[model samples]
Target: MRLPFTHSKQEPANTRTARKLCWDSRDEYFRCLDRIGVLNPNDPTQKSKINANCANEDAKFDENCATSWISYFKEKRVVDFKRARALEEVNRNVENNQQAKGSQE
Candidate 1:
Protein backbone atom coordinates (compact mmCIF):
# COMPACT_ATOMS: atom_id res chain seq x y z
CA MET A 1 0.00 0.00 0.00
CA ARG A 2 1.10 3.55 -0.69
CA LEU A 3 1.70 5.73 2.34
CA PRO A 4 0.46 9.28 2.59
CA PHE A 5 2.97 11.96 1.43
CA THR A 6 5.67 9.40 0.90
CA HIS A 7 8.03 10.98 -1.60
CA SER A 8 10.92 8.51 -1.93
CA LYS A 9 13.07 5.84 -0.26
CA GLN A 10 15.50 8.52 1.00
CA GLU A 11 12.77 9.81 3.23
CA PRO A 12 12.05 7.56 6.20
CA ALA A 13 8.70 7.23 7.93
CA ASN A 14 8.71 10.16 10.34
CA THR A 15 5.44 11.54 11.58
CA ARG A 16 7.11 14.36 13.48
CA THR A 17 9.04 15.50 10.42
CA ALA A 18 5.97 15.35 8.25
CA ARG A 19 3.90 17.21 10.79
CA LYS A 20 6.58 19.88 11.06
CA LEU A 21 6.82 20.32 7.29
CA CYS A 22 3.05 20.61 6.94
CA TRP A 23 2.76 23.07 9.78
CA ASP A 24 5.58 25.16 8.32
CA SER A 25 4.01 25.26 4.85
CA ARG A 26 0.65 26.23 6.26
CA ASP A 27 2.17 28.93 8.39
CA GLU A 28 4.05 30.32 5.38
CA TYR A 29 0.92 30.41 3.26
CA PHE A 30 -1.10 32.05 5.97
CA ARG A 31 1.54 34.68 6.59
CA CYS A 32 1.70 35.46 2.88
CA LEU A 33 -2.07 35.72 2.67
CA ASP A 34 -2.12 37.91 5.74
CA ARG A 35 0.45 40.30 4.33
CA ILE A 36 -1.30 40.43 1.01
CA GLY A 37 -4.49 41.26 2.88
CA VAL A 38 -6.28 41.25 -0.47
CA LEU A 39 -9.01 39.27 1.19
CA ASN A 40 -8.41 40.62 4.66
CA PRO A 41 -11.53 38.86 5.93
CA ASN A 42 -11.61 41.72 8.41
CA ASP A 43 -10.93 45.02 6.58
CA PRO A 44 -12.13 45.88 3.08
CA THR A 45 -10.20 49.04 2.05
CA GLN A 46 -6.75 47.50 2.61
CA LYS A 47 -7.59 44.68 0.24
CA SER A 48 -6.98 46.69 -2.91
CA LYS A 49 -3.83 48.29 -1.54
CA ILE A 50 -2.29 44.82 -1.24
CA ASN A 51 -0.29 44.98 -4.44
CA ALA A 52 3.17 43.56 -5.26
CA ASN A 53 4.66 44.94 -2.07
CA CYS A 54 2.21 43.01 0.06
CA ALA A 55 2.50 39.88 -2.02
CA ASN A 56 6.28 39.82 -1.93
CA GLU A 57 6.50 40.58 1.74
CA ASP A 58 3.84 38.04 2.53
CA ALA A 59 5.58 35.30 0.59
CA LYS A 60 8.88 35.74 2.40
CA PHE A 61 7.20 36.02 5.79
CA ASP A 62 5.14 32.92 5.05
CA GLU A 63 8.18 30.84 4.12
CA ASN A 64 10.00 31.81 7.30
CA CYS A 65 6.93 31.24 9.46
CA ALA A 66 6.35 27.82 7.94
CA THR A 67 9.93 26.72 8.59
CA SER A 68 9.81 28.01 12.15
CA TRP A 69 6.57 26.18 12.85
CA ILE A 70 8.06 22.89 11.64
CA SER A 71 11.11 23.33 13.83
CA TYR A 72 8.93 24.24 16.79
CA PHE A 73 6.76 21.16 16.37
CA LYS A 74 9.79 18.90 16.01
CA GLU A 75 11.15 20.18 19.30
CA LYS A 76 7.76 19.91 20.96
CA ARG A 77 7.28 16.33 19.79
CA VAL A 78 10.69 15.35 21.11
CA VAL A 79 9.89 16.81 24.50
CA ASP A 80 6.48 15.14 24.57
CA PHE A 81 7.99 11.77 23.69
CA LYS A 82 10.61 12.14 26.38
CA ARG A 83 7.97 12.96 28.98
CA ALA A 84 5.84 10.01 27.93
CA ARG A 85 8.79 7.64 28.15
CA ALA A 86 9.69 8.96 31.59
CA LEU A 87 6.12 8.47 32.77
CA GLU A 88 6.09 4.94 31.43
CA GLU A 89 9.32 4.18 33.21
CA VAL A 90 7.97 5.59 36.46
CA ASN A 91 4.77 3.58 36.13
CA ARG A 92 6.73 0.39 35.51
CA ASN A 93 8.88 1.01 38.55
CA VAL A 94 5.79 1.63 40.68
CA GLU A 95 4.19 -1.55 39.44
CA ASN A 96 7.34 -3.53 40.23
CA ASN A 97 7.54 -2.02 43.69
CA GLN A 98 3.92 -2.92 44.35
CA GLN A 99 4.53 -6.48 43.24
CA ALA A 100 7.60 -6.79 45.44
CA LYS A 101 5.73 -5.48 48.45
CA GLY A 102 2.89 -7.88 47.80
CA SER A 103 5.28 -10.84 47.66
CA GLN A 104 6.78 -9.89 51.02
CA GLU A 105 3.32 -9.83 52.59
Candidate 2:
Protein backbone atom coordinates (compact mmCIF):
# COMPACT_ATOMS: atom_id res chain seq x y z
CA MET A 1 0.00 0.00 0.00
CA ARG A 2 1.18 3.50 -0.70
CA LEU A 3 2.07 5.78 2.19
CA PRO A 4 -0.50 8.42 2.93
CA PHE A 5 1.73 11.37 2.03
CA THR A 6 3.82 10.02 -0.82
CA HIS A 7 3.93 11.88 -4.09
CA SER A 8 2.14 10.69 -7.20
CA LYS A 9 3.89 9.53 -10.41
CA GLN A 10 3.93 13.11 -11.66
CA GLU A 11 6.38 14.14 -8.94
CA PRO A 12 9.89 15.04 -10.16
CA ALA A 13 13.00 12.90 -9.66
CA ASN A 14 14.63 15.41 -7.29
CA THR A 15 11.44 15.32 -5.20
CA ARG A 16 11.52 11.54 -5.10
CA THR A 17 15.16 11.48 -4.04
CA ALA A 18 14.47 13.86 -1.18
CA ARG A 19 11.47 11.86 0.10
CA LYS A 20 13.46 8.64 -0.11
CA LEU A 21 16.18 10.12 2.07
CA CYS A 22 13.75 11.37 4.69
CA TRP A 23 12.08 7.99 4.75
CA ASP A 24 15.50 6.38 5.07
CA SER A 25 16.56 8.57 8.01
CA ARG A 26 17.86 7.13 11.29
CA ASP A 27 14.65 8.19 12.94
CA GLU A 28 13.60 4.92 11.41
CA TYR A 29 10.20 6.21 10.56
CA PHE A 30 9.97 3.71 7.76
CA ARG A 31 12.13 1.14 9.51
CA CYS A 32 9.98 1.26 12.60
CA LEU A 33 6.90 0.50 10.58
CA ASP A 34 8.72 -2.22 8.71
CA ARG A 35 10.15 -3.80 11.85
CA ILE A 36 6.82 -3.52 13.58
CA GLY A 37 5.58 -5.64 10.72
CA VAL A 38 2.95 -3.39 9.24
CA LEU A 39 3.99 -2.65 5.67
CA ASN A 40 6.06 -4.49 3.13
CA PRO A 41 9.35 -2.78 2.31
CA ASN A 42 9.45 -4.37 -1.12
CA ASP A 43 6.26 -2.59 -2.10
CA PRO A 44 6.86 0.68 -3.93
CA THR A 45 3.47 2.08 -2.93
CA GLN A 46 4.08 1.61 0.80
CA LYS A 47 6.29 4.65 1.10
CA SER A 48 3.78 6.83 -0.66
CA LYS A 49 1.05 5.72 1.70
CA ILE A 50 3.18 6.47 4.73
CA ASN A 51 4.09 9.90 3.38
CA ALA A 52 0.53 10.69 2.54
CA ASN A 53 -0.55 9.67 6.02
CA CYS A 54 2.10 11.84 7.61
CA ALA A 55 1.01 14.74 5.45
CA ASN A 56 -2.60 14.24 6.44
CA GLU A 57 -1.85 14.05 10.15
CA ASP A 58 -0.20 17.42 10.15
CA ALA A 59 -2.24 20.42 9.05
CA LYS A 60 0.91 22.14 7.83
CA PHE A 61 1.84 19.21 5.60
CA ASP A 62 2.06 20.13 1.93
CA GLU A 63 4.25 19.70 -1.12
CA ASN A 64 6.63 22.24 0.36
CA CYS A 65 6.78 20.24 3.56
CA ALA A 66 7.81 17.15 1.67
CA THR A 67 10.17 19.26 -0.39
CA SER A 68 11.98 20.64 2.67
CA TRP A 69 12.24 17.28 4.40
CA ILE A 70 13.50 15.64 1.26
CA SER A 71 15.93 18.50 0.59
CA TYR A 72 17.87 17.85 3.80
CA PHE A 73 18.27 14.18 2.98
CA LYS A 74 19.10 14.97 -0.62
CA GLU A 75 21.84 17.41 0.44
CA LYS A 76 23.44 14.87 2.73
CA ARG A 77 23.34 12.19 0.09
CA VAL A 78 24.81 14.54 -2.49
CA VAL A 79 27.71 15.43 -0.22
CA ASP A 80 28.40 11.76 0.46
CA PHE A 81 28.24 10.92 -3.23
CA LYS A 82 30.59 13.77 -4.05
CA ARG A 83 33.13 12.57 -1.50
CA ALA A 84 32.95 9.05 -2.84
CA ARG A 85 33.30 10.30 -6.39
CA ALA A 86 36.36 12.33 -5.45
CA LEU A 87 38.00 9.32 -3.79
CA GLU A 88 37.25 7.19 -6.83
CA GLU A 89 38.74 9.84 -9.09
CA VAL A 90 41.92 9.93 -7.01
CA ASN A 91 42.24 6.14 -7.11
CA ARG A 92 41.77 6.16 -10.88
CA ASN A 93 44.46 8.80 -11.27
CA VAL A 94 46.87 6.85 -9.08
CA GLU A 95 46.24 3.67 -11.01
CA ASN A 96 46.81 5.44 -14.32
CA ASN A 97 50.06 6.94 -13.05
CA GLN A 98 51.25 3.52 -11.88
CA GLN A 99 50.41 2.01 -15.25
CA ALA A 100 52.33 4.78 -17.01
CA LYS A 101 55.38 4.28 -14.74
CA GLY A 102 55.31 0.53 -15.27
CA SER A 103 55.28 1.03 -19.02
CA GLN A 104 58.35 3.35 -18.75
CA GLU A 105 60.20 0.71 -16.70
Candidate 3:
Protein backbone atom coordinates (compact mmCIF):
# COMPACT_ATOMS: atom_id res chain seq x y z
CA MET A 1 0.00 0.00 0.00
CA ARG A 2 1.24 3.46 -0.84
CA LEU A 3 1.14 6.17 1.79
CA PRO A 4 0.06 9.59 0.54
CA PHE A 5 2.58 11.55 2.61
CA THR A 6 6.34 11.75 2.43
CA HIS A 7 8.73 12.33 5.30
CA SER A 8 10.32 15.75 5.15
CA LYS A 9 13.14 17.42 7.06
CA GLN A 10 10.87 20.37 7.83
CA GLU A 11 8.62 18.11 9.93
CA PRO A 12 9.22 17.84 13.68
CA ALA A 13 11.30 14.89 14.85
CA ASN A 14 8.34 13.46 16.78
CA THR A 15 6.02 13.76 13.78
CA ARG A 16 8.52 12.05 11.49
CA THR A 17 9.05 9.27 14.02
CA ALA A 18 5.32 8.70 14.45
CA ARG A 19 4.82 8.54 10.70
CA LYS A 20 7.58 5.99 10.38
CA LEU A 21 6.12 3.88 13.18
CA CYS A 22 2.66 3.83 11.59
CA TRP A 23 4.14 3.00 8.21
CA ASP A 24 6.09 0.20 9.86
CA SER A 25 2.82 -1.25 11.11
CA ARG A 26 1.32 -1.05 7.64
CA ASP A 27 2.66 -4.44 6.60
CA GLU A 28 1.33 -6.13 9.72
CA TYR A 29 -2.03 -4.44 9.21
CA PHE A 30 -2.10 -5.61 5.58
CA ARG A 31 -1.34 -9.15 6.67
CA CYS A 32 -4.14 -8.97 9.18
CA LEU A 33 -6.47 -7.77 6.45
CA ASP A 34 -5.32 -10.62 4.25
CA ARG A 35 -6.06 -13.15 6.96
CA ILE A 36 -9.48 -11.58 7.34
CA GLY A 37 -9.95 -11.85 3.54
CA VAL A 38 -10.34 -8.12 3.13
CA LEU A 39 -6.92 -7.38 1.64
CA ASN A 40 -7.90 -8.05 -1.98
CA PRO A 41 -11.01 -6.20 -2.97
CA ASN A 42 -13.68 -8.21 -4.66
CA ASP A 43 -15.45 -4.97 -5.38
CA PRO A 44 -14.30 -1.42 -4.80
CA THR A 45 -17.62 -0.67 -3.15
CA GLN A 46 -16.97 -3.39 -0.62
CA LYS A 47 -13.80 -1.70 0.53
CA SER A 48 -15.50 1.68 0.74
CA LYS A 49 -18.44 0.23 2.57
CA ILE A 50 -16.20 -1.45 5.07
CA ASN A 51 -14.28 1.77 5.57
CA ALA A 52 -17.47 3.77 5.94
CA ASN A 53 -18.61 1.51 8.75
CA CYS A 54 -15.20 0.93 10.27
CA ALA A 55 -14.51 1.55 13.97
CA ASN A 56 -11.18 2.17 15.72
CA GLU A 57 -12.09 -0.40 18.37
CA ASP A 58 -12.42 -3.16 15.77
CA ALA A 59 -8.61 -3.45 15.39
CA LYS A 60 -8.74 -3.51 11.59
CA PHE A 61 -6.62 -1.24 9.39
CA ASP A 62 -8.40 1.95 10.34
CA GLU A 63 -8.67 0.68 13.86
CA ASN A 64 -5.00 -0.18 14.10
CA CYS A 65 -3.91 3.15 12.72
CA ALA A 66 -6.38 5.09 14.82
CA THR A 67 -5.49 3.25 17.99
CA SER A 68 -1.77 3.58 17.37
CA TRP A 69 -2.05 7.31 16.90
CA ILE A 70 -4.39 7.56 19.85
CA SER A 71 -2.02 5.59 22.03
CA TYR A 72 0.87 7.79 21.01
CA PHE A 73 -0.95 11.03 21.71
CA LYS A 74 -2.65 9.66 24.77
CA GLU A 75 0.74 9.10 26.35
CA LYS A 76 1.80 12.63 25.53
CA ARG A 77 -1.54 13.98 26.71
CA VAL A 78 -1.27 12.14 29.98
CA VAL A 79 2.15 13.59 30.60
CA ASP A 80 0.96 17.08 29.70
CA PHE A 81 -2.08 16.74 31.92
CA LYS A 82 0.02 15.64 34.82
CA ARG A 83 2.39 18.53 34.35
CA ALA A 84 -0.48 21.00 34.15
CA ARG A 85 -2.10 19.59 37.23
CA ALA A 86 1.17 19.77 39.12
CA LEU A 87 1.64 23.40 38.14
CA GLU A 88 -1.90 24.23 39.18
CA GLU A 89 -1.38 22.55 42.52
CA VAL A 90 1.83 24.43 43.07
CA ASN A 91 0.14 27.73 42.23
CA ARG A 92 -2.72 26.95 44.55
CA ASN A 93 -0.33 26.12 47.39
CA VAL A 94 1.59 29.32 46.82
CA GLU A 95 -1.63 31.34 46.83
CA ASN A 96 -2.76 29.67 50.04
CA ASN A 97 0.59 30.31 51.67
CA GLN A 98 0.43 33.96 50.66
CA GLN A 99 -3.08 34.26 52.01
CA ALA A 100 -1.98 32.70 55.30
CA LYS A 101 0.98 35.08 55.51
CA GLY A 102 -1.22 38.10 54.73
CA SER A 103 -3.76 37.10 57.40
CA GLN A 104 -1.00 36.54 59.98
CA GLU A 105 0.52 39.95 59.24
Candidate 4:
Protein backbone atom coordinates (compact mmCIF):
# COMPACT_ATOMS: atom_id res chain seq x y z
CA MET A 1 0.00 0.00 0.00
CA ARG A 2 3.04 2.21 0.00
CA LEU A 3 2.86 5.10 -2.43
CA PRO A 4 5.84 5.15 -4.74
CA PHE A 5 6.11 8.91 -5.18
CA THR A 6 6.15 9.90 -1.50
CA HIS A 7 8.20 9.01 1.53
CA SER A 8 5.09 7.81 3.32
CA LYS A 9 6.29 4.49 4.58
CA GLN A 10 5.22 5.63 7.99
CA GLU A 11 1.83 6.75 6.69
CA PRO A 12 -1.25 4.95 7.99
CA ALA A 13 -2.46 3.92 4.58
CA ASN A 14 0.87 2.37 3.77
CA THR A 15 0.09 -0.52 6.09
CA ARG A 16 -3.02 -2.63 6.42
CA THR A 17 -2.81 -2.61 10.22
CA ALA A 18 -2.90 1.16 10.32
CA ARG A 19 -5.83 1.28 7.91
CA LYS A 20 -7.76 -1.17 10.10
CA LEU A 21 -7.10 0.92 13.17
CA CYS A 22 -8.34 4.04 11.39
CA TRP A 23 -11.49 2.33 10.19
CA ASP A 24 -12.24 0.91 13.62
CA SER A 25 -11.72 4.30 15.24
CA ARG A 26 -13.94 5.95 12.66
CA ASP A 27 -16.71 3.46 13.31
CA GLU A 28 -16.45 3.87 17.06
CA TYR A 29 -16.64 7.64 16.76
CA PHE A 30 -19.57 7.47 14.38
CA ARG A 31 -21.41 5.09 16.70
CA CYS A 32 -20.97 7.57 19.50
CA LEU A 33 -22.31 10.31 17.27
CA ASP A 34 -25.34 8.13 16.48
CA ARG A 35 -26.04 7.65 20.13
CA ILE A 36 -26.00 11.44 20.56
CA GLY A 37 -28.31 11.91 17.53
CA VAL A 38 -25.59 13.78 15.69
CA LEU A 39 -25.28 13.34 11.97
CA ASN A 40 -22.91 16.22 11.30
CA PRO A 41 -19.94 16.20 13.61
CA ASN A 42 -18.27 19.11 11.86
CA ASP A 43 -21.15 21.50 12.50
CA PRO A 44 -20.16 24.45 14.71
CA THR A 45 -23.11 23.91 17.00
CA GLN A 46 -22.33 20.23 17.25
CA LYS A 47 -18.77 20.78 18.36
CA SER A 48 -19.77 21.14 21.96
CA LYS A 49 -22.18 18.27 21.70
CA ILE A 50 -19.46 16.03 20.30
CA ASN A 51 -17.02 17.13 22.95
CA ALA A 52 -19.51 16.39 25.65
CA ASN A 53 -20.83 13.13 24.26
CA CYS A 54 -18.01 11.58 22.30
CA ALA A 55 -14.75 13.15 23.32
CA ASN A 56 -12.99 9.87 23.98
CA GLU A 57 -14.16 8.20 20.77
CA ASP A 58 -13.28 11.33 18.82
CA ALA A 59 -9.84 11.35 20.33
CA LYS A 60 -9.23 7.75 19.25
CA PHE A 61 -10.39 8.51 15.72
CA ASP A 62 -8.09 11.49 15.53
CA GLU A 63 -5.20 9.45 16.86
CA ASN A 64 -5.62 6.55 14.43
CA CYS A 65 -6.46 8.38 11.23
CA ALA A 66 -4.46 10.74 9.08
CA THR A 67 -5.61 14.36 8.89
CA SER A 68 -6.88 14.01 5.31
CA TRP A 69 -8.76 10.85 6.18
CA ILE A 70 -10.23 12.43 9.30
CA SER A 71 -11.93 15.15 7.25
CA TYR A 72 -13.13 12.60 4.73
CA PHE A 73 -14.68 10.46 7.45
CA LYS A 74 -16.36 13.48 9.04
CA GLU A 75 -17.98 14.44 5.72
CA LYS A 76 -18.88 10.85 4.94
CA ARG A 77 -20.70 10.42 8.25
CA VAL A 78 -23.22 13.08 7.29
CA VAL A 79 -23.73 11.57 3.87
CA ASP A 80 -24.19 8.11 5.36
CA PHE A 81 -26.75 9.34 7.88
CA LYS A 82 -28.73 11.11 5.15
CA ARG A 83 -28.66 8.04 2.98
CA ALA A 84 -29.97 5.88 5.81
CA ARG A 85 -32.76 8.35 6.52
CA ALA A 86 -33.77 8.40 2.88
CA LEU A 87 -33.92 4.64 2.81
CA GLU A 88 -36.09 4.57 5.89
CA GLU A 89 -38.42 7.18 4.43
CA VAL A 90 -38.79 5.25 1.20
CA ASN A 91 -39.52 2.02 3.10
CA ARG A 92 -42.10 3.72 5.24
CA ASN A 93 -43.85 5.14 2.19
CA VAL A 94 -43.98 1.75 0.55
CA GLU A 95 -45.37 0.16 3.68
CA ASN A 96 -48.03 2.86 4.03
CA ASN A 97 -49.05 2.43 0.42
CA GLN A 98 -49.36 -1.32 0.87
CA GLN A 99 -51.42 -0.89 4.04
CA ALA A 100 -53.70 1.59 2.30
CA LYS A 101 -54.24 -0.84 -0.58
CA GLY A 102 -55.05 -3.63 1.86
CA SER A 103 -57.58 -1.49 3.68
CA GLN A 104 -59.21 -0.40 0.43
CA GLU A 105 -59.62 -4.01 -0.61
Top TM-score model: 4
Q: Give me candidate 2's TM-score against the actual structure.
A: 0.36
**Considering lDDT, where higher is better, how would the candidates rank from best to worst?**
4, 1, 3, 2
Residue-level lDDT tens digits of model 4 in 1-105: 445646442445647898899999999999999899988888998899999989999988988888889999899878977899999999999999999999999
RMSD of each: 14.6, 11.7, 15.0, 3.4
- Model 2 score (lDDT): 0.51
Order the candidate numbers by TM-score, best to worst. Answer: 4, 1, 3, 2
lDDT of 3 by residue, 1-105 (tens): 434455331221346665666555554544444455553332455566445443332243333354445455435544755789999999999999999999999
Off by over 4 Å in 3: 1-69
Candidate number with greatest lDDT:
4
Candidate number with the higher lDDT (1 or 3): 1
Off by over 4 Å in 2: 1-70
Give the poorly placed runs of model 1, Cα more than 4 Å off: 1-65
Steric clash count of candidate 2? 13
TM-score of each: 0.39, 0.36, 0.37, 0.78
lDDT of 2 by residue, 75-97 (tens): 55447657889999999999999
Q: What lDDT does the true structure give each of the candidates?
A: 0.54, 0.51, 0.51, 0.87
- Model 3 is weakest, by summed lDDT over 10 consecutive residues, at 55-64
> How high is the lDDT of residue 1 in model 3?
40
